[model samples]
Each structure stands twice: as C-alpha cells, then as structure tokens.
Target: MPFKINTNLSALDAYNALARVNAQTNKAQLRLASQLRINSVADDTSGYRVGKELEGKVTLMKAAQGNIGAAKNTLSTAESALTNINDLLIQIKGKIAEANDPTKNLTALANDINALGDEISAIFTNTKFNDTALLSGSALPSSSNFVFQTGETEKTTINFGTMNTLDLASISSSGATSSNITSLSVSTLETAVQDSLGKIGNYVQRLDVKDDYLTSAITNATASVSRLFDADMAIEQLKATKGQIGQQVSTTMLAQLNFQPRSLLTLFQ
Candidate 1:
C-alpha cells in the first residue's frame, strides 16, 4: 500500500507471478523440443546418474555380443575343417577294407592308401582362416595347444585335443607296415572312421554351447540399450499437455503485470 516512485506494489506482485509462469513455460518449451523431461543435468541429476550407469552396461553388453560373434566364426571354421577330415577318413576306411580282400591288388591298394594319408595331411595344412590354421599342430614351444583370448576375463582354447597325428602319419606306404595299419580289418577301419566323426561331433557340441551363450548376451544388450535411450510416449504426451497450459498462464501473467503498472490511470479518471 506504500506509494513508492520506482516500485508499484501491484506491479511488483504481477511481475513476480509472471516470472514464475515464465520459468514454467521455458521448462515446457525445452521438454517439447527435446521430447524428454530430463534434457540437462540440472533437470534431474539422479536420472542422469542412473542413465550413465545404464549406458555403461549397454556398452559392455554390446562388446560381449561381438565377442560371441568372433567365437562363433572360429568354431565354425573348426567344424568345417573337422568335417573335411571325417570325409577323408571314410574314403580311407572303404579303400582299406577293399585292399584287405585277396581279390584286390595289394600293391595298388597300398598306393591308394598312401595317397589318402598325403591328402589328409594337405587338408590339415590348408585349413586356415585369417592366417590361423585350425588343424595344424601348434608350434608353441611350451605346448601343443593354443588359447584364444578375447580379453582378460574371457578365453576359449583349441586343444587339437587328441587328434590322431599318428593315424594321419600312417596313411603312407612307408608306414603301411606298422602293426596299426597291417593289422587293421574292416571292423577296425570302421571303428577308426567312427572315431574321427566322434571328434568332430564333440567340437560341434562345444560350439553350440558357445553360440547359445552369445545369443543370450546379444538379447540382454539389446534390451539394455533400449531402456537407456528410448523415450516413453505416454509420459511425454502428458508433459506436452501440461506445457501448453503453462505457456498460456505465462502470457496471461505478463498481460496482468503490464496493466498493474498502469493503475495510476484510474486516479486521473
């Protein structure tokens, strides 16, 4: 009620209301433009912190998904190489069985068998991708196995596990006289062939397990990324409605402020 030259009380009250409304309008404008309630750290510090943690989880999960991809490729290569080896064993077994019969030419059978051994060796030597041979013996001075490490926490190794390097060597005519081959009957050759198939089957099983693990990781990562960055349409829609009302209120408050300073005009009338 005090008459002051510089500050009219009614004008000051109107202006205070207008300023509050303006602040709300600005907030609404930002939310509408960004389509998000939490655009800046100032809007919601706790939300920003939680979002950062979720973002980190998304990054790690994505990397794990990639690790699974590389692992699958490696296992696939191994499976393919073993398949070739199995096929070779089958051919060798059939030839050896025919050679064992008196009706077949023993000398020609020996040549064919020797040729097969050489072919299997060739398969082993040639089975490589990205400069890494899957079938070849590891030349690591300390061991016959090779460990594939993706990171400090994850690793998968190929042990050539008990591949018959000896049986492979025996496919030659020079090694034909060995008891293992000379004594090999139709049943024995069949058993050897089956054993080769078994090794490949075992490797494939392990790959299946690895594949499953990676598939799960990819799914989880995909979900986490969605949670961290995706918007909620329902929540945003409600906010947009509220923002519209706030802007209107701000404009009305500004009009009221202008009129309050003009109250002196009523005295002149």
Candidate 2:
C-alpha cells in the first residue's frame, strides 16, 4: 500500500454548507427587521429614491394641513365679529329712528350712537388670532411657509384670500342731519348691510375651498407614503420559503462532499 495523507473533504464540505446557511439566515433576519424587500441601496436604488420623494411630500402635506386649521379658526373669528357688527348697525338704525321722532330728544341719542360706532371700531382693530388681526384698518399679511422634509415647497400657492374691510368710519355720525339716517331709506342701509354680508359670504366660500384643498392634499400624501414604505406580506412569504429551500439544498450538497472522503475506507477492504 502507498503511504499517503488523507484530506478531510467532509470537513471542507461542512464548512461550505455552514457558510451558505449563515448567509441565508442573515438575509432573512435583515428582511424581517427592516420589513422591506429593498432595505439597502444595493437592493433597489430607484425604489429608495422614489420612496424619499414621497416621504418629503407627506411632510409638506402635514404642514399644509396645519395651516388650513389655523386659517379656518381665524376666518371663523372674522365671521363672528361681522355678525356682531351687523347687530350693532341694526341697533344704531333703531336709535336714529327714535331720534327722528318729535317726542324724543337728539342730544342723548347722539352720544349713544357715537359709543356704538367706537365699539365697532375697537372690534375691527383689536380682534386677533395669535395677535395678528384679520380685520384691522390696515390689511395685515396672513401668510405662512410650509417647510418640507426636503427643505422645499411641494406646492407654493397657499392663499387664504384677504379679509373684509368694513370701514366703520364711513357710517354717518351726525344725529339730525345725517345723509344715511335723516334721509332714512331702508334701501340704503339694506344695501350697506347686504354688501357687508356679501363680503362675509365670499370669505366663507374661500375658506371652504382652502379646507377642501388641504383635505385632498392629505389624502394623496397618505397614499404616496403607503406606496413608498409599506411592506408586501405576500412577497416576503415567498422569499422566506426560497431561503429555507436554499439552506436545505446546500446541506445536501455538503453531505455528498463528505461521502467522497469516505472512499479511503475502500483501500482497507
């Protein structure tokens, strides 16, 4: 018999099998932890790119939604104040009618009417949301910038329209010889009130349009986010199955390699 050293092919086969099994195990774990088919850039670079884009849009949409909420509240306050002004104007009209009568005195009524005008003026000046008055004498900007995760504006045009300017000073202050009150025509007061009411209606309509836009933006953002990051359970199940099969096949191949080393036993026979 020839003197020879035998190599442990079984050990080499076992090592190879174990290495493959370890690799498959690691891949399965990564998929589970990340809950994504394309966890790394190597997996799907395009998916990562588009996923980040959608994520940015979602962030912008959230900020826009918050702005809409603030706009709604401010507009509501404007609407409420306008209603109070309407009531005040009606009261002033009644006072003027009483003053016109021969039985009533004008001096006391003039003071009361002046006070009502002052109160309306104050409401216009002082009414504020976060200390930014919507109906001030000067038109203040009710503007905000929505910053996205990508540090850019996804859609820049966010206008809540302008606030109504119902100038209280324009109303007549004279008691006995006023153009609006002394020459009292329901048509004139009605026209003024109707104009204010029309402005209020217009603002309310604008508010509704903004609200609807925000709602739609949020919906679309949510859908985009889901598409970008949500996992596909069906695809993951298939991958897991394939990983198990690969592990099994490698183990079988390793066993066959081990059998090759056992051929040395035939020499002894």
Candidate 3:
C-alpha cells in the first residue's frame, strides 16, 4: 500500500474495526445488564417472536389455572352442602322409623317428624356459597354438565356432570302420621342422598387430579418461557469480558496506525 499524507487508509481501517468491537462490547454489556438474551427484536428476530408467543401461552395458562381453582372451589362448596343434606336425610329417616312404632304418641311423633322435615327444607333452601345457591331446586342447571377451562387451548375443558336438585320435596316426607309413616319408603330417600354424595365424591376426586396436572403444566411452561427469554449470566459475563478485551486491543491498534503517517513525515525532516 502507498503512504499518502492527506489520508491514512490503515488508520481508517483500524478505526472501523474498533467501532465494530465497541458496538459488540455494548451489546454484550446490555445482555448482562438486562439478564435477557433477546432485549430487542433486532437481536434475534425469530427467537424474539417465538419467545413472545410462548409468553402469551404461559399467561393464558396461568389464567386458566385460576379458573380451575374457582371451579374447584365451587365444587367443594357444593359438596359440603350435599354432605349436610345427606346428614339431614338420615335424621329424617330415623324420625320416620320412630313414628312407625305403635307405642309412640301419634301427635308428639307427628310434631317431631314435621320439625325434622322443616329443617331438611330449610337446608335445601339455605345451602349457598358466594351468594349462589348450591342445593336448592332453583340452583339446578338445565344441563347436568358444568364445563371448566383447564388449559390455554379453547378445546381444553373439564366437563362435570350429574349436578341435580336436592330439594326436600324430592323425598316423600308429608306422611307424619304413624300409619302413613309405616307405608313410606325410607329406602328411596336413602338412595337419593347416597347417589348425590357419590357424584360429589367423584367430581372432587377428578378436580384434585386436574389441579395437580395444571400445577405441573404451569411449571413446565414457565421453564420453557425462561429458556427462550432468560440469558445465561455466566456466558453473558464471559462474552462481555471478551468483547471488552477486543475493544481495548482494537483501540490501541487504531492509535498506533494514526502514528504511522507521522513517522512517514519524519523521513522528509
């Protein structure tokens, strides 16, 4: 290369190289400071897009988990109400059996049996959670199934079936007389309580399984999001150190190259 007084090509080349090194150093430092591999879309376009999609999915999944929790709570509240209703039915059955005995006073037995029936009706009407009725006839849905969202996908749902009215009127308890009580089918009331309890038990078990599954899924999704977005601190620090060294070396070379043209001028002196 020919040496020129007006322009030093070697110094220009060294300065450009130093600028590139400085830019790289700044990028590495930014990664270390932010603790994210993809701070901007320009850093890694495809990775950034994919990471954003994954982040959205994670957010939706978290919201779905909250929905699942609410569904579980609703089921639990219903289950507790049904359990109380079941106990009330058992007491009603005992009262009916006592009224069946010939030795008991008919009027006193009728009063006791009617009192127990009133309590059962009261429970059926009063059983509520979050101000929403759970056991009353008014609370029964037209469709048996209650769907709960369990995942990010629109199709992912947990369908709960078998919700039914637990009204005291469902059971034949108007027969307060001993002769009438002897004819009443206590077995029918027993069967209704047992069936409702069984359905509630099954629903609670399924909800528990779904809750565990969501917990695991959230953990895995969080890990995936982290892998896409989070920077490895150790690797970033090492890269920053290497870039810093390269910048120092390039700056020194640029300074040396600037002095080379002056040395050529000393030849004339």
Candidate 2 overall Cα lDDT vs. reference? Answer: 0.61
Q: Residue-wise lDDT of candidate 1 within 97-175, one digit each (tens)?
A: 7766777776676677777767767766776666666556563213435454433256655555444344555675455
Top candidate on TM-score is 3
**TM-score head-to-head 1 vs 2, winner:** 1
- Candidates arranged by lDDT, highest first: 3, 2, 1
Lowest summed lDDT across 10 adjacent residues in model 1 is found at 139-148
lDDT of 2 at 178: 32
For candidate 1, give the lDDT of residue 80. 72
TM value for model 1: 0.73
Please write out the lDDT profile of model 3 over residues 1-269, one tens digit for every residue: 77787898998999999888888888889988999988989988988888788778878878877877777787777667667766766776776677667787766666666666677666666766577666555654445445667777642232223334433443335546645655545465557766766776776677677668778877887787688788899988888899889988998999998888787867798
* lDDT tens per residue, model 2, 81-145: 76776787787788778877866666666666767777767776776777766665444554422
Count of clashing residue pairs in every prediction: 0, 0, 0
Q: Between the candidate structures 1 and 3, which one is better when assessed by lDDT?
A: 3
Off by more than 4 A, model 2: 1-25, 137-139, 142-197, 264-269
For model 1, state the Cα shift of residue 230 in Å: 3.8
